[model samples]
Target: MTSPTSRRTVLTAALAAAAGAGTVASAASASAAPTSPAGSSAAPGALVDNRFWHTYTDWRCGTGDGTRVLPGPRPGVVIAVPAGRTDYTDPHTGRTAAWDYATWTSSVHRSAVPATEVIASWNARTPTGTWIQVELSGVYGDGTATPWFVMGRWAAGDGDIRRTSVDGQGDPHSSVWTDTFSVDDPASGVRLVSYRLRLTLYRTPGSRLTPTVWRVGAMASDVPDRFTVPASTPAPARELPVPRYSQNVHIGQYPEYDNGGEAWCSPTSSQMIIEHWGRRPTAEDLAWVKPGLPDPQVCHAARQTYDYQYEGCGNWPFNAAYAATYRDLNAVVTRLGSLTDVERLIRAGIPVITSQSFLKEELTGAGYGTAGHLMTVIGFTPDGDVVANDPASPDNDAVRRFYRRREFENIWLRTKRYDAAGKVRSGTGGVCYVYWPTRTTPGQQRVLRSLGLL
Candidate 1:
């Protein structure tokens, strides 16, 4: 969980320049009201903003190298390039065998309204000895664009390859790396209008290593402070029997993946779902992981979904993408308006992964407070309380816990409140990671269609 204070610092800095120019106040006010369903008048807190995916363009390799598009993970194409030395010499080092790079840029996307923040995310698979890095920039009010900022350098399977200022990698073959960057102010007197992304692939010369990129996207929005309450009543509360998996039990199991259990909540909740669907990873999938662990698949999930920049496995989109790797599963990161929306998924037999934070007194049964945490909402209890598989518990057996309905809803849906620092910090705003059968049954399709997700 991210602390409210830290969130406030980032949000404040990002919106500061805009506020000074008196631009942010209007944008925020415009989006403060909610949007309504199609064919209906707008509701309170119903502002709608667009999020777009800008595909790669003008891909080219430096001298002595080549580039081509290859088949990528479902519906997406990958840019593949070979390892070779660049023709240009390094001015500082005066060396001829400098690292080579293949580059691609995304088309600029203009938002419907001025955006408060832009988040960039990507997925890639690289062989040993090769790596990928991403950079982002934005244009505000048709003025000069912000300088390109490095998102991160990533390689799968290698634990030492951290997302930092350091370039290149020692070895290859890691799982896909997905990370998000919140774009902040570039200059004063500029209202953000458009944004762009650049991806660079680097590898050792003659290493025969090729890296493949699956998908890259961005979400830009003026995150509202509140959401409209659903007009319909929630389904009667009833607890669903969900299996438990605790992060505490796995502590110290894999130091490479955020020192193991302490940070494994996201993957642990994901594992429970994978098992519920009867699609647990086979022995071969866990072969690379050291033996003797109770659920090696959880470890595999952690490694595959880990975000180098965030330095944790709790990224919402990354976790959803990881679950999609399994057959018969499709996942996405989205925000739900109310618990009724959650109940719809539950009735369809789909568990939801939600991000939330609360003070100890706010949520009973959970003894700690988190800046942010992920839990599986398996079902609701009779009387409309929450029945969740909370991986943050002390042990697997203790993972099942309940929370008062009103308290849980307030914490989950309306987390953007004043923090101890007297700054208004924003929460995820009811964000959820939902994984369902790629091929849904008629019943499932009905529920999804009702929610406008089908």
Candidate 2:
């Protein structure tokens, strides 16, 4: 959904339309910025950089109602299976194989009626007929009251909605009836709409584990461009000279593996920023929050009422508060979706640190590949140039440099995950931050301080 020209108009429309609406109102009134279930809705104090506020909406998923448009921005689902393997087994396969798989089934409804039921099955077969079964339980949402439809099979094969039924290993699978939903008029002040799709899977006997694969399609819209990673090349090294922020303070003072796991992008980026500041950072100093956190099992079984597993990364800003942390740093996580927002932050004097390579693709449409991998925005150049620190360049050597304003804006929105795909799908929103020590000492305090726990 596109942003309205004025917040006043949008707010008025939302409030008026929400009078009789139930779930729709909940989403439109979602926090303007990051928030926890228990936190107040008032604006945050130290979010110092607020330029990316609107990016959250731009990256919102599922026909704009939150189901997250699949193949639209991120992977729809992820499954892990345990099994025994030997030299002949391709253990690393992402697809389901004979040794094991999983099954999920669900019944969903729209406006309180059974809308549809579905079962998705996936698996990988070995030449020897040994195989694993993987299944998906899903509900289809056309953004109307009808719950999304799902089809399940006991055997591994394609499931079709048009067909009355597909063959399955004979087992009793229950049936659920759902309702039909429709939003016939947008002029009725209800342009945004949604539906439900709940799913789960059951296993068949004798298979070591279930190996399965399930493909999903929108009954009303096209499949999304979920897997595209944009590319961009940085400017030629000679023209833009990097600048120096703190000549005496070298980032090498800190290193990766100090905070979160280094394999993921957010943690790795956070580690780089802390090192650049010539200060050590701890997990306490920065909040590494993401959405849909703490798998169902972790949340249910955790000992504490406020379990970390239940809180997911989307709560980073809150974690910052919990950790008694100060200052958050990292690149524009949402790509082109937040350019105007970043501009606002840089103007706020927040000492934003990020990689120059990120904007490279934006400058040169999907043009990726460069060595100036990690850089930070130190200050604006003369005549309003965007000054940055390039640690990789020989001339810059972590020195600050400048680029044209026009070029910077163009590149900003182009490189983010949101910009790469225009928005985030449900259960896929992500956040990143760096934890730099307030002082140059290494201790648990640094980590706690960054996380705001201390």
Candidate 3:
């Protein structure tokens, strides 16, 4: 399996550069203290800083061209008037169609931490024939400017245009790998000092329907270079009753999506969380799958989240975007500081889907080495070992297993590692997807807030 290559591991050139990049921005508010939420015990701050713009004030402050803000509890931006109509050819379908479009560009956001990498995530409602594109342009620590990068072109469904991540986008200083913006080399110590996000809303010509974007933001981080991170103390042992689904079970399924289920760890893990939240694709959603498949939901998730450019289902933000497609659910791709942050989430009934790369010997009982792999961290054992719903299992039943805590954390949280060939490789550096309901309970909201997620 090529790339066992999760998001940033698919390419060889500068793949190791992925390790040094940092991730999240808080257009909302940065939690300078982990103790902001009463009773929280995480470290001073998560390694990442998140800045999400979902409030009415944030939209009003942006430079809008034919776009306006919708006010209320869940305010968003929508097309006030067509800035213009343009013809766009769907790369996947080769169908050229005219669309009415509008845009909003955010004010510059200086990173609380000089970030070596940044990942952008958004929550929006795009109806049929309406979609949105998110882009980022930043100034490097050296005061040099970066071009605006197309982070994603997305619609809730694939009928209009295939939701995708733009490839071959970068500069002398940095590059966009799948969905993450990474500095060319973190060793250079040249980081992104500030940045702005631009949102372009599109709709079929003559249609009043417009995409409403609820949130658009970036995560910026500068995890120190380390092959092994300091060990985190475990919280009270507890396990969330998360469902398990193995990607191995869907082998040879849909050849169109990344040559089938063999590379669908991202979506398979996403489906598990969707179901754990009491949400699942309807029979209509699974109708496209061949009848008699054991877990049609996983297959459905894979297709819905596929990125045509990457030719794989492992695009990090794409998976989070797909999970948010479910009713009332909200998802974002962000990095957690440590397992202690995860424990705080577990106490709040949240399960984290983490990205990491490891050798067969690095993680006990994994029995496999991957340049990159995704697994669901469901709970902790009494002794603080990990209980995970790993999608790489032989079967769904075997998806749940335990691994030594020290080994798991080192493998999952480290930014650098030695590959099976004894070559230097990049690790995910604690990258993860956190999903929850929009109308979260006060306690859940508190936990998310404490983590700088709200």
Score every model by TM-score. Answer: 0.68, 0.28, 0.90
Top of the candidates by lDDT:
3
Cα misplacement distance, residue 224 of candidate 1 (Å): 3.1
Can you write out model 1's per-residue Cα lDDT over 20-58, one digit (the tens) per residue? 110000111112212211221113343323332312221
Residue-wise lDDT of candidate 2 within 1-454, one digit each (tens)? 0001111111121112111111111122211222211211113332111111111222222112112212332223222332222121222222332222222211111111111212121111112222222221222232322222222211211121010111111111222211111122222333212122221222223433322212221111111122232233333122222223221122221222111111111222233343444433344322332334322111111111111211211112211111111122222221112223334333433334343223245433323333123234545543555665533332224344565555554333222233234443211111222233323334533432232212
Candidate with maximal TM-score: 3
**Model 3 stretches astray by more than 4 angstroms:** 1-46
Tell me the tens digit of each residue's lDDT in model 3 across 248-353: 9888888888755459888999999999999999988788989898899988988888888778888888888888878778888888877998888888899999
What does the lDDT read for residue 427 in candidate 2?
A: 14
Q: Quote model 3's TM-score.
A: 0.90
Model 1 misplaced regions, further than 4 Å:
1-73, 80-101, 127-131, 141-144, 163-193, 201-212, 226-232, 236-243, 252-256, 282-291, 305-310, 316-321, 324-331, 347-349, 418-426, 436-454
Better of 1 and 3 by TM-score: 3
